[model samples]
Target: MEARSRCRLPCSYYMTCKCCMKRMDGKGKSFIRRTLGSTGFVQAVGTKAGPNGTTLVSTGLSDLDKIIGGGIPLGGIIMIMEDIEAPHHLLLLRYFLAQGVVHGQPLLFASPLTSPKSFLGTLPGLTKGKDSKGNVDLQKSGQSADGLRIAWQYQRYLNEQKALETRRQRQQEIASQSWASGRLHASSLSPNLSSSVTSGSLEYTGTFDLRKSMDQAMLNAVNTVCFSLQGETDMAPLHGQCAAFVTTHSRSVQEVPNVGRIAMQSIYAPQSMHLFSEWKMLSFLAWLKGIIRTANVVGLVTFPASLLKPSVLVRLQHLADILLSVEAVSDDHKEMEAMLTDYQDISGLLHVHKLASINTQVPSFPEASTYSIKVSRRKEVVLEHLHLAPVDVYGKGSGNAGAAQVLCSTPANAPSSLDF
Candidate 1:
């Protein structure tokens, strides 16, 4: 084990740096505020402009990346919605992970729902297939490949085998930890040994350790996506009563002031459950905020909006800055609230934040396409309640009429944050 350095912290406290890492300024006072505020700082400095291939675009979630820049932050939380079985969330995650792999950035998925073989194998960039000799090779099957993807089956097999072996060894260690205590008799450990032996025989092909695997993968080209359901039982749906019931049942598992290092969430809904409520949007939003800050991961939550009111839909829109309403394309839009809004003008530019019908159809990309709505900071609107501007839909070019490119109209006397 590496030796930890000792630091003279604020309040004359001498703490070891190993367990409780401290960030101190030149004067030696605690920089807790600064460190906590750094998240916002890192977000403001967006990813650098480069070749289009270098950037990882997301499916429509305008304000999401604002908290962590254009791409997911290191060790950040990511949610995927599986309610409609659209796999949109998984596809987007795979795209980001593929980009990360190409760029040497690691990714981690903390849930067991996603299968690396079948789910991730579909991605063009990261998916590795094989040749006749069972050697690693690239799939040049189509123009979408663009000479970037490893689409061979044998190569994928090799990678899967390697991952399996690694996971098996790690699991063995964890499973055998009881041996260290010497508290259990051989007979008592029989069941445990049997389970371990059986598990090892299964040939762990994918990264099985959701938490640890994700942590380590984030340091490299590995991208992990965790699978978790978002609602309750089918009969009752996740209504207020159900939420309250679950909350009561889960009170013991949840802890306040969670550790910053771990991506654990206080609230979770299994796939077998259903949610029902008019204020469902508000509850979901509050829960999402808690999950985001607590889990420290990006997530994609899915819920039915058919029974919700227009006010609830609007609240949900605000709650989730980046909304991907599958209903729009799934023929459920008839019952759901309107997603498109009237176009507005900003500083002589046409700002299309609320679109009535930009297009009901999904956009196409060469491989897989992900839409990113980069939302700016909240700005006050005149002659009406203040409204936040959405991302710059158009490319960031001069004279672009997108919300991002155009500057907000300033009052003659009111000072602006930019002025300072």
Candidate 2:
């Protein structure tokens, strides 16, 4: 009676005692049983399992990944609308390719240039330090000659420190909970998770230094296939090549799965536009999209939006799962200069038109749709929210000069610490 009340059953009689079986199984046993029959997902390097059974790969930029609701998912197409005057799209392409190289993933690079292989040489090398701060250089430490400048800069520094501390504490709490729950065990966890505890770690996405080129040895080790669309009169040959590449990386039960990245730079540029009609180009894109949809591959295509007609551009945008556009900021644009406080630091603007929504109905919306693209002193690309310049009572220029004068004229040397 005591054993029955405790719901303890012998192994031989386990089937007869439903209550005992349920008590012994626990939640972990149920999870294990559910997954036992299912074919496990590929847990490759530089990839993580996202919500809704989708796998995510980094876009080379950590901030960009966060903005796009965790990295780019496998089997999705990313389209970037190019700026007519600037090569900002190339920055995105370089970073995307560089990330694949770092992860040792197979790459298929197609470009309108005669020598697509040469573009690989210009890829930025990964930054040495593991710190994410390497991407943003804030001149916050040194005391400025101006009192107001010193106060304002230090205040910004304090705020950044607080943010970092809060983030660190949150990460620690998450790690503790994951460990306590035992939901992610060594045997159950994917190689992607076992290798890296947290997705935010440096192993997942690396910071790159734009000033330095990747090491020659590292570039030589990667399996890179480059195709030149400089003078190809027919889209058939390119389409065939892509088909073969996708076949090599297709998901299969027999073969060990690996991630593949396909990058097409300026696909509809002037050089290639003469060879194929708009219909042919659209057909090619549709075909490419179909092939990559099933395979464990992600494709990034950049085209000059200004050259295409509105109807054609709309069709192209609709084809992309993730759509982004870059706009160059003119140096002499007085109106923009007056509107943004950090006008001098702004190089361009990044607009996120769409985000990849795979295996789910709910669309992911970022906190901001537009972000300012800034190049740090170390040549690292950084994205930040645009801050409007402060307005005065008269609605003229920033009233910083008068405020600085008033603060500096105080009898006591500026209050030692910030209030907040």
Candidate 3:
């Protein structure tokens, strides 16, 4: 193992640099902030940008990305609290994991209800028979060798076998770079990106079966562990084990050859009451915040908010960098809401209770901006602005409309939508 150099002052800490022997002046400090912030600094700096410039990772849903101002920022801890039991909750979780798999981000599943392997089995395959985050080789028959020769068929078969073996070797190389999501290299197509396909823009997509084993190389690049609640109540050991798991993972990340460090997130969904206690759980979550900020890993957990005490929820809410809750709505309610607003096919209500650093103490993404989610066959999980689509048949009152000439109306080129 190579011995890592230890610096007296860590730029991230805003401390004096002992090696430099000179204080980083205001200009130097500003530059460091911009660099770190842009790379997903865990610290919140102001109301507009996250404490730091946020490194936006795709939520795997473009619409959702737009609503949240461009995907979940790396180093963020998002809690999905549910007021009521809802199927959308499960779907959302699937979308989150599926997105990670598609991007080839390493996933660490820590749930008693669903084992990582079993949950993956239920995931749909990539649409194009290939993993979006990685490539899948297609088999092709080798050309016939010397059709006149008796050994031609055998030679062709051997050639085909060699090709398959080579492909396997290549796949192994890809898998070894487990934490390298396509987001890093997907832009290699062109430098003028706006005119072309943005990774988030709708394009080719496919299903990925989580149940199947990932490439051995990819598997080696990450660490995945599951904590099966042994029905024991001692929280100390469980807490230590969980914390150790995260700590070790963070440390090992340094060994991988990655463009940027992959953000770490531990997904925990307690199946029953025996898994964890509120106090211990709170402590575990608190410890998580430090790891998230210092190590630059994100934390995602699904908790039954209603089932837990309000105090616990409040503390967790404050501790988490981001909070989200799914509001279950029936089909009839969906239609009712849709008729009143443009929320057609409303799956459920998604509440953005708190968004850290955006006003710090209050929700700031979109105030009073109703939000709803809907999914597509292509695994497009949309969390868009909810609108009411009123029915106005016979062209009586179309939503997309043009007002007739009014007494004080401005000319075509002038501003008319609103006036100062």
Candidate 4:
């Protein structure tokens, strides 16, 4: 039979052809393997390597990654766009936790955005413990359900045990190898290690103590902590409470006190929190800067994209290492095109392992490893906007256009450049 005709036949014909081909080729497994090669096997069995180094995986949005370097670093921040604290943002948080669990790293997620329940609900391959009556179990489901929390708790124990075992093994290997006049064996034992395994993840935790007050030591432990609140308020409240938060606390950061330890307050008011005057907003940010001294704590404050004035935002941009802007995915043609372009660039930088962009139409970002979707159910558009010129967006040239600044200049927030 012709090749095309044979291929067109049912299971019986394919099986007979396969056996005959294998017999003729002297192949053991199957004729398909011999014909297709290694690349075919790779495609069939989808196993890809995890990210190397401290790579920041973006949320497949270019503008988002521009400010925050793809997404946030593994043991770093994943800024949330707080809009009544939705489930999708919570899902993204769990994704971060999953990455931490698989790679054996601790994750620190501090948000006033949503309650912990919203976050617990979105974890990938994770669920809450069940009741006595056989409910959806969370703590112990004999699955990877509690992987994130378990990984965090047991990491120290594992590290200590591994270190002791490694030392003992090394000593034993040294003793076992007999010296031929001080010459070791040709095949010596060497432990297999990788760059990440050696460097290890940073362990900086944020523990809330109501009585102790916010201090330097506590601040040092927290790498990235976000303060999420409402935005778009009237003129009076903005100046009143917000102004008080700045004048009272922010002013304190500037003064030098001869005491036990300096108190550092974290104040985050996202634009979504509520509407406030430009002056009030600037004062709040200035207060945040005052609290961030020679400390490791990465302070994050969220605000609405709509309310921010360019002049005030440009000034605020200098206070953060990474700036993240969040927008709801839009259906407008021009906006969609912009979003697609941003998504493609971010996917390239973040190097997401698996990505799907689902919605009205999938913009062809062929080179991306991540997925993009155009779904109607309110998707968050996150961008760091790494290549965007801050000057063009918020600098003097642009006369305060309605276009919001997602992230601002990094140099503005540098410790040396900061004005205390």
Question: What lDDT tens digits, residue by residue, belong to model 4 across residues 121-165?
Answer: 333331111122222352146235545445777767856865765
- Say which candidate scores most in lDDT: 2
lDDT, candidates in the order shown: 0.29, 0.73, 0.46, 0.31
Provide C-alpha RMSD values for all models, in order. 17.9, 13.9, 15.6, 22.9
Residues 352-371, candidate 2, lDDT per residue (tens digit)? 88888877899886676678
Model 3 misplaced stretches (Cα beyond 4 Å): 1-51, 129-222, 230-232, 236-238, 249-271, 334-338, 341-344, 358-363, 367-369, 377-379, 391-420
lDDT string for model 1 (137-206, tens) is 3322332453356556556665676677556445444433332222123223333423322221111111
Clashing pairs in 2: none
Cα error, residue 113 of model 2, in Å, equals 1.1
Q: What would the TM-scores of all predictions be?
A: 0.29, 0.71, 0.56, 0.30
- Of the pair 2 and 3, which is ahead by TM-score? 2
User: In model 1, which runs have C-alpha deviations exceeding 4 angstroms?
Assistant: 1-69, 72-90, 96-124, 127-285, 302-309, 324-420
Q: For model 2, where is the 10-residue window of minimal lDDT? A: 12-21
Off-target runs (Cα >4 Å) in candidate 2 are 1-41, 129-202, 391-393, 396-420
- Candidate maximizing TM-score: 2
TM-score of model 2 vs. true structure: 0.71
| C-alpha-based local distance difference test score of model 3 | 0.46
